[model samples]
Target: MAIELAGRPHRVPEGSSLADLLAALGHAPQACATALNGDFVRREQRHATRLAEGDRVVLVQPIVGG
Candidate 1:
């Protein structure tokens, strides 16, 4: 299946969860915030949040500031 990841098209295996995608991208689940189709998906829910075709996924990492 293909999904719009951070505004770019990306292919992923069928039945893939958000956590799976993060792993594939080498992102630690605790180090970023995720949104699906413009809605926020909590970290704890990533394992259960199944991704669908054409779904929009955004992952943002926090930055420390002075």
Candidate 2:
């Protein structure tokens, strides 16, 4: 299935979850924040957030400031 990942088209196995996508990309989940279709998905919920075709997903570095 194809979905928009980080603003680019990405393909993954069917029924792939947010966690699976992160693992597939070799990204450490703890080091970034994720969102699906413009909604923030908490780290604990990544595994349950199943991705759909054409979904917009973004994984970005978390802002750290004092």
Candidate 3:
């Protein structure tokens, strides 16, 4: 399956979930926030956040702005 990560395209394994995608990108679920096709995906949803063939996965770093 292929997903858009930060505006770029990434080809990932089929049936991959948000958690799986994060791991593949060297990111920890606890350290980032995500949105799938404009829908905010909470931490608890990671496991159920399956990536479709053309799904878009947008990951953002935790906000720490002063």
Winning candidate number (lDDT): 1
The C-alpha RMSD in Å for every predicted model, in order, reads 0.6, 1.6, 1.2
Question: How do these models rank on TM-score, best leading?
Answer: 1, 2, 3
Better of 1 and 3 by TM-score: 1
Q: Looking at candidate 1, what is the lDDT of residue 1?
A: 100
Which wins on lDDT, candidate 1 or candidate 3?
Answer: 1
Tens digits of per-residue lDDT, candidate 1, 3-59, equal 999999999999999999999999988999999999999999999999999999999
Q: Each model's TM-score?
A: 0.96, 0.91, 0.90
The window of 10 residues in a row where model 1 has the poorest summed lDDT is: 23-32
Better of 2 and 3 by TM-score: 2
The local distance difference test score of model 1 is 0.97
User: After best superposition, candidate 1 residue 41: deviation in angstroms?
Assistant: 0.3
For candidate 2, list the clashing residue pairs, or say none. none
Q: Which residue pairs clash within candidate 3? A: none
- Could you give candidate 2's per-residue lDDT for residues 1-66 as a string of tens digits? 999998999999999999999999999989899999999999999999999999999999867899
Candidate 3 lDDT, tens digit per residue, 1-66? Answer: 777888898999999999999998899779999999998999998989889988888898977889
Candidate 3 overall lDDT versus native:
0.89
Candidate 3, residue 26: the lDDT equals 92
